[model samples]
Target: MLRKITSLLLVGLLLVGLLAGCGAKPEEPQTEEPAKEEALKIAMVTDVGGVNDKSFNQSAWEGLQKAENELGVKPGYQESKQEADYSSNLELLTDAGNDLVWGIGFLMGSQVEQAAKDYPEQKFAIIDNYYENPSENLLGITFKEQEASFLVGYIAGKMTKTNKVGFIGGMDFAVIHRFDYGFKAGVKHANPDAEILSQYAGAFDKPAIGRSIAESMYAKDADIIFHAAGDTGNGMIEVAKEKGKYAIGVDKDQNPDAPENVITSAVKRVDNAIYNVAKDLKEGNFKGGTNITYGLAEGGVDIAPSSDKLVPKEILDEVAKLKEQIIAGEIKVPANKEEFEAMK
Candidate 1:
């Protein structure tokens, strides 16, 4: 009877062990859920001026930054250190499956066209340039930079204490030349005797060269220097501060660290263009294979105002009147040098 009782106890122990083993099966491996995606994937390929050139590229990037913050986009930008990088930089963004890609300047026209063609499924927008035969996936944005320049140039012509103003451009490109002739026309209109000095920096990112040219202009009694030279323009601003003169900004309202020296900015709204494109794309109103040109009538370009000892109330009033005239078709602004010369 003792042996039988002990065997029953051992059998009971074995059964309990088996039940414990079955209940505690090996733990399974853990997995994590995927990350949430951004609303839209947006990318930009900048010209050689880079993203922080304090002018054109910077203005465009500022718009992209705003879109990322408010428009629900995953924004990315690639800076081209040289002209040769434009195509590859575009390719990098396009290959990443970006929903919308933009090329910042007219300098990027060719590369953007090639990229849009290479990736027929991709969408592209270029500023200040339109393709002769734009692909179905490409869009172009252009501004009446000349109109804006004319406004500021008018002010410069009136504001120049020395009866001399200058325009320094980045590269001798057609766009820069447009700025030149329109400004010349305005200067001629406002102060018929005001001498206009114009030169090209031969490059977009050279502040030193820009500063040197501006200094030369200042030495020659150019009291106001208007620049479309990217960071080169920033240098001109510095020189303006040094000479206690005035400078004009472009592509953005660049009052700069020394706002007092800037009489006003001849503004071109690259920011608005980029921001609007993103907004349109998100709203399903993206227009591909099209060109949208903006002028003062469309709020795409205008002149910035200044208060601290540069422009007087009367001058601002005059500028405002002129702007109205331009908007209302009372005045015709020139788009190119030839047109401006003809008007003269």
Candidate 2:
């Protein structure tokens, strides 16, 4: 009985030791699952000009595409066929739970306004428009269009052999007026003797009307024609090409399509603005309920040097000086007829 007791005690000690050894073994390393990435959803609604219009619509879409490739955003877009489609198009993106939606033109001011009021939970942005009292969720993006137009107008002033230049506008809206005013200022700055004439297409998408108006201007001895008529501007450019005269393109470079005719383009950098806004949202720094104006100083607007013929170095040097002056607040480009007259 004594031997059995001793053996039992020894066995119990061994079992306890084995149990402790088992318990002391380190647990299998547990890996924390990699944190899931947040979704990036950004969308844009095109004005009547569509994504390929190569104007504001195309410019805005380019920005969204850029954000998609560089920022890892899944971008969406809906093209509007007419003015009536703005709200529904905006709703399409918002209904799909997009993080942000953008409207490309000022023509949709009322539509976006109503939509913003109706969908307070959704964030919204509109280009080429300024709202006096925007909703907390709405962003008003207006460019210093005059600043950019001035540069191009100066170019036109220096390059016009006819000593006569023209401007064809779309819709005669405040935005178009701003462009016209800045362009006139630039032309006057460069060549005070140059004659300036302007007319409106009465529609943003009417190319035939633009061509007809441009034809009249050209016949009237206006050799250099600048257009801010969205899709209609394309027709104006075609007229310039047909006449073998010069055309200053808008929004984006038209040199790729008509290098021979397109002397230069007044670029709005809509793509950059749109992309930056999306980037801000992704970085958690989007500023809403404010009017953000990007001008020559901000690299938001300028004349594209995408032509077959190079600008004279003297002309370029002069333009650079003017640009510097504008940035330094030594110059203020006008946005209206009254303001332009005051500049004189």
TM-scores, all models, native as reference: 0.88, 0.90
Q: Whole-model Cα lDDT per candidate?
A: 0.87, 0.90
- Cα RMSD, each candidate: 4.8, 3.2
- 146-250, model 1: which lDDT tens digit per residue? 888888888888888899999999988778877888788889889999999999998888889989999999999898889988887788888988888888888
Report the lDDT of model 2 for residue 257. Answer: 66
Instruction: Encode model 2's per-residue lDDT on 180-208: one tens digit a residue.
Output: 99999999998999999899888888899
Backbone clash pairs in model 1 (N, Cα, C under 3 Å; residues 3+ apart or in different chains), count:
0
Number of the predicted model whose lDDT against the real structure is largest: 2
Candidate 2 global lDDT: 0.90
